[model samples]
Target: MSIKITGTGSYIPNVITKNADFHQHEFYNIDGSTFPGDNESTIQKFKAITGIKERRYLDDNLNTSEMAIIAAQKAIEASGIDPETLDYIIVAHNYGDVKFNCHQSDTVPSMATRVKHHLRIKNPSCVGYDVLFGCPGWIEGLIQAQAFIRAGMAKKCLVIGAEALSRVVDKHDRDSMIFSDGAGAAVLESSEEKGGILAHESATYAYNEANYIYFGKSNNAEAPQDLRYIKMNGRKIYEFALVNVPKAMKSCLEKSGKSIKDLKKIFIHQANEKMDDAIIKRFYNLHGLDVPEYVTPMTIQELGNSSVATVPTLLDLVINGEIENQELKDGDVMIFASVGAGMNINAVVYQY
Candidate 1:
């Protein structure tokens, strides 16, 4: 049995904050720095950096788990599966659900239970677990879900990669401007064959280390700080992706007995258009493959990175037909890859 993402779902706050709105003078600093950003008129350089028009956000009021539950419920609905029947609940996070003292995130063990309760998942015996990683969380979760089902450890699972990036945004930081609160989830079940997460390969590089590449820390369980906001040596992280992603992709394909040529599409993590191009160029040189013309580069220009939820949101767009007329077919191979601050890269091969 293989694990297939039978159902896909996502949640972005209905609010549609635009890059133009960020241009308002209020967002400008007295020093002339503007977190709100520059108008499209002045910037002729990176004109079409990201085609994303807008992104969703959650008020400062909510936690990652709350957003996660919302997204998971949608997935559950789409699959028409009973929450109680879910055998495993895995949440990939860079932050906790709540303060350890009063919140569940600090002690991630409680995350699955809380999610079930939030979404009214049935029964009281489902096991809850958590996985921690940076932007690579989604792909990692997909691969793990397949393993669990294949092992018969789970019959049905709820996998989520929700991120509340807006809560941590530093209004004065241009880098943070791209961030927004968001959530994405999928209810996976045991598939006899055909669809879902078909193959996966991933590894970490302990030797190459840098700053701005670690998770937050919490002093105490009640009010955790350990898994706070994202950190990374942006420059180094990009370089790492350029080298590491290609390597990971090749290994994943080899282990699965497939190649890029066999894939109908490649769903790479949407970090930035520049990064996308860098990886695209790398792909051409190594495997002689170019990202299919119909591939979706969903990263938002002003919408900051949303970590784990990135790929799934793109997947949701595809299933919902938001991806538009494209060249993907029912049995095409699609690869999802991610390289994050941890100096870790994950690559998964899927039959979509």
Candidate 2:
């Protein structure tokens, strides 16, 4: 038996927030000092580094769970699976549902429970839960589902990655531009067919890198210390990822017993353009090969970094042919990798 993603779906928010929209906002440094230069120059620099021109925001009337539900519905439809037959529902997220204009996160019910409730699956045996593994959460969830299947604990599982990062961002900080809102989901099941998930690697480096990406007070010094927003030391994260992510990917591929030449595509987390490019380059260098064109697909230019949602959302887009010049075929070997808070890193070697 093999574990495979039977279907995939994603929900891209409708509200478009362009870089030009931030021109009138006051930007500040971590110490509350005014940002150097004008908004135009700042935005240009941001674009040059991150390659983000715009991002999507969840509608004011909806929350992260709702987005997950929508994506889940599409995935279920695509899989032609009965909701009542699902053995597990795993939702990966960071901040729970943060309503528009609200500071508190609603996690009492748990995002997975919320999705199961909304999906209206009535089977009491359909276990549901949540994971908080930073941006790599979805890929981690996939690994978990595969483990469950391998252990004969489940037959079918629904995995989702959803986030409303826009609601948790400190608008006063320039880094805020990197975040947005979105959700993606997939149905994983045990099948007789071959070419499924072959191997995976996961690690957490919290000793000295624990605070690279964190929730901290706003950049504006006057902002309430009691209220915190998503924050990160970009330089630290870039350096850390460059050193570790490629190693993880190489290890995963090696464990799968697949050669570097077998890799058809890499669905990496859309954190930053330059950082991702460098990681891919380094990964190829380790294999004594040049990076192949179109090997790494990205959605960061239009979707920004939606916390845990990036990898799954990008996968859903490519699987559905929404991303141009990218396509997957039978017998194709691919790698899914990501790095984020927890200073966590993970990679999955999959075959389709």
Candidate 3:
């Protein structure tokens, strides 16, 4: 059996955080020292570097699971699939149920479990769980869904990636500018049709610990540590993605027996505009072809980085004609790639 994504959905909170607004608030260096740059120039520099003009954040009352439910509802509605009939719900999130009740974070019941409850999915056998694979979590969830369908263990699965990064990111840290909140979901159904998830590849560079996220106080903090916020060494992550993501995409393409010439669009992780351009350019070079302008569609300029939600949300936008001059026809081949905090990376090929 082949696994096909019958529907796609995404939910971004209504609150817009513009880069220009950051200067109104004070920021701190990683060492907790006062940042010295002028806010206006800093915002301009950030725009030039990341191409992010703004991003959305969940409301105070919302949490990761709730966002996942909203996105899942849309996906089920689009797929015309009854929630009662879903065989599984796989939620991919870096921080599970962050900002629960506007005060705390917890993962005991799993984001998928909470989403299942919210959707009122009555089937006791509709397995629900969460996957933690950094930014590639959603794509990894898709891989698992494909496996279940191929193994005849499940006929349909809802794959969701939701994050409330706004709640977890330290307001004082520079990393806060790039993180956002949102969720994206897809309904994958078993089909006799041959092309859905064609082939995929993933890897982890465990030694690249400096690029990973951790929960702790700043290096220079003297006060009692509060919540552990998202932290990272930007240079390491840039170097890692520049080298590995293209390799993973190329391997996935080779595994799927498809060539660069056969692809339609490449939905890459909305991490950074320049990094994405470089990665795609390198991938094309591997095939001895120039990178096509339209081959990789992007939303990072407006969405920032919501980790795993980036790719699926972009996919939904393209599928529904939300992106200009981008639409998928039946039998079109597409590629998805992401790299992040696990020092983890993944790539998947799909046919629409």
Candidate 1 segments exceeding 4 Å error: 24-53, 97-109, 215-229, 297-304, 326-328
Worst 10 residues of 3 by lDDT: 218-227
lDDT of 2 at 131: 97
Whole-model lDDT values for every prediction: 0.68, 0.95, 0.87
Error of 1 at 201 (Å): 1.2
Two-way lDDT contest, 1 vs 2, winner: 2
Give the residue spans of candidate 2 off by over 4 A: none
Per-prediction TM-score, please? Answer: 0.82, 0.99, 0.96
Best candidate according to lDDT:
2
Cα error of candidate 2 at position 139, Å: 0.5
- The alpha-carbon lDDT assigned to residue 45 of candidate 1 equals 28
Clashes of 2: 0
Residue 12 displacement (Å), model 3: 1.5
Please report, as a residue range, the 10-residue window in candidate 2 with the lowest summed lDDT: 307-316
Q: Count residue pairs with overlapping backbones in model 3.
A: 0
In the range 1-352, model 1's lDDT, one tens digit per residue, is: 6667778788766656666555532332323344244545422323354444455676656677887888898898899887888888888767655432232235434555678777776665687777776778877877777787888778898888877766554333344445666778888888777666666888877675535475443222333334354444556777788887877877787777776667666677777667767776686568866656665445455344677887777777677876556445677788888877566689888876
Q: Per-residue lDDT for 1-352 in model 2, tens only?
A: 9899999889999999999999998999999999999999999999999999999999999999999999999999999999899999999999999999999999989999999998888999999999999999999999999999999999999999999999999999999999999999999999999989999999999999999999899888888889999999999999999999999999999999999999999999999999999999999999899999899999999999997889888988888898989999999999999999999999999998
Clashes per candidate (backbone, < 3 Å): 22, 0, 0
Runs in model 3 lying further than 4 Å from the true structure: 100-103, 219-223
* Rank by lDDT (best first): 2, 3, 1
